[model samples]
Each structure stands twice: as C-alpha cells, then as structure tokens.
Target: MIRRISAALLALGLATAAFAQAAWTDAEVRKVDAKTGKITLKHGEIKNLDMPPMTMVFTAKDKALLEGVKAGDHVQFAADKDAAGEYVLTAIQQKK
Candidate 1:
C-alpha cells in the first residue's frame, strides 16, 4: 500500500512538471543577426516570462538557433531569462 501511494505521488509529480513546462510563443522576426547571435522579434505575450506583446531583441542561447530565420518570417519560439537576467532565445522554428 505504501509503495502504491509512493508510485502514484511520483507519477503525479512528473505529470505536473511536464504540464508546467514553458509554452512556445508566436512571433514575427524583425531581424536576425547571426554575427551577434541575436534576433529581434515582434512577439505575442510570453506567458512564461509574464511579458506583454512587444518588439524586443533577445540573444540566442546558441547561434544555431538563428539558422534559417530571417526578417519577416513567422515563427514559434521559447525563451528564458539567463544568469545575466537577459532574455535568451532557447528554441525557434519557422511557423507552418
């Protein structure tokens, strides 16, 4: 009985963690500076960051994250605050 209760609790924890994961935001690319590893975007509200819709620049966590992206492209992305407290683009993909 104790083992079953523990297993149930573990599963619940895992499910909650998955559900709490950051959501992707819709954005329009305003510029991509591969040289600086930065992208400017006019983006919708970033629910995870509690940010409202606005145009802003974000450093890409990896230069590769800028690949295939260009100005005027519609994309979906996820961002997070880095150790420096600056927003960093963590994931990005061209919208279908």
Candidate 2:
C-alpha cells in the first residue's frame, strides 16, 4: 500500500509540472497601443483558455510588455483572463 501511495504522489507531481508549463501560441502582432496597454494579435490555439485560432485585441498585463515589438512581427505569446474578465497578455516574445 505504501508503494502504491508513493507512485500515485509521483504521478500527481508530474502532472502538475506539465500543467504549469504555459502552452504558448504562435501569433503575429497586428497592432500595438502602448497608451492603452493593449495589443492586437492574430493567434493560433490558446490551449490554456481552450480558445480557437482568431484575431483579437488583448490588454497587456503591463504596457512595457509591448516594447521592442510592433505590428507585423511574428511572436509567441500567452494570454489569460484577468479578475476583471478582460483578456490580458501574460507573455510575449518575438520569433526569430
């Protein structure tokens, strides 16, 4: 019974680790509005939110997140809904 419990715990830990890794989605910056801390993205599946591919605007968690990136740049980003029920850009990185 002890061995079975240990195995279960190990499995649970691995599952948690996998889930903790944010599933980034491919996107292209369609627009950026620094004043409003929002960016428009044409993106593929956002796995964390179960959202299908689409083009939409998202508020960045911080306006500075838009720095060094601009319209037409291919990027990878992660987004999630904030407590205010607004979609917030959590991570963004330009694609090489």
Candidate 3:
C-alpha cells in the first residue's frame, strides 16, 4: 500500500512537470499575414523548442489563431514542432 501511494505521487509530480514544460513564452509580434496564416515574432527563449531568443516567422496551427493579433502587439504564446519538423504556433494571446 505504501509503495502504491508513493508511485501515485511520483506520477502526479511527473505530470505537473510536463504541464509546466508547455508554459507560454513572451514575444512581440513583428508582423502578421492572415492570408498565409503566418506571423513573425521577436521572442524570448522558447523552452519547449530548446530555442534561444530570435526573430523569425512561424505558421499558425490554425488561421484563426491569427485573429485579433497584429504586428507590434506584445504577446505570450506557445509553439511546438509539427509532423514536418517545422515550428508551428499552437496558442497565442496579446499581453494585457
């Protein structure tokens, strides 16, 4: 019983760690191309992607992700590599 409880606690901790790994990253929108579903960002470190701060363009996972976002907006976002190994914006929101 004690071993089972310990295992459950360990699993819970691992789950929390995984969730934290997907935390939002800070960025400033440099450009937005709604027609192409792509946006350029000058961003801080993207921890999940193991990337350093840089300005680059990324395709949004969905064109709707570009809605209400515009160039020069300060934002927080999350990105992940797609099947083709290209970074795709998964989520984004303008900073308040």
Q: Which of candidates 1 and 3 is the stronger one according to TM-score? A: 1
TM-score to true structure, per model: 0.79, 0.78, 0.78
| lDDT, candidate 3, 1-96, per-residue tens | 999999999999999998676669999999999999999999999987899999999999999999999998999999999999999999998887
| lDDT by residue (tens digit), candidate 2, 1-96 | 999999999999999997578788999999999899889999999988989999999999988999988999999998889998888998898876
Clashing residue pairs found in predicted model 2: none
The TM-score between candidate 1 and the true structure equals: 0.79
lDDT of each: 0.94, 0.92, 0.94
lDDT of 2 at 44: 98
Ranking by TM-score: 1, 3, 2
- Lowest-scoring 10 consecutive residues by lDDT in candidate 1? 15-24
lDDT of 1 at 20: 62
Model 3 alpha-carbon miss at residue 90, Å: 0.1
- Cα deviation at 55, candidate 2, in Å, is 0.3
Off by over 4 Å in 3: 1-21
Q: For residues 1-96, what per-residue lDDT tens digits would candidate 1 score against the true structure?
A: 999999999999999997567588999999999999999999999998999999999999999999999999999999999998999999998898
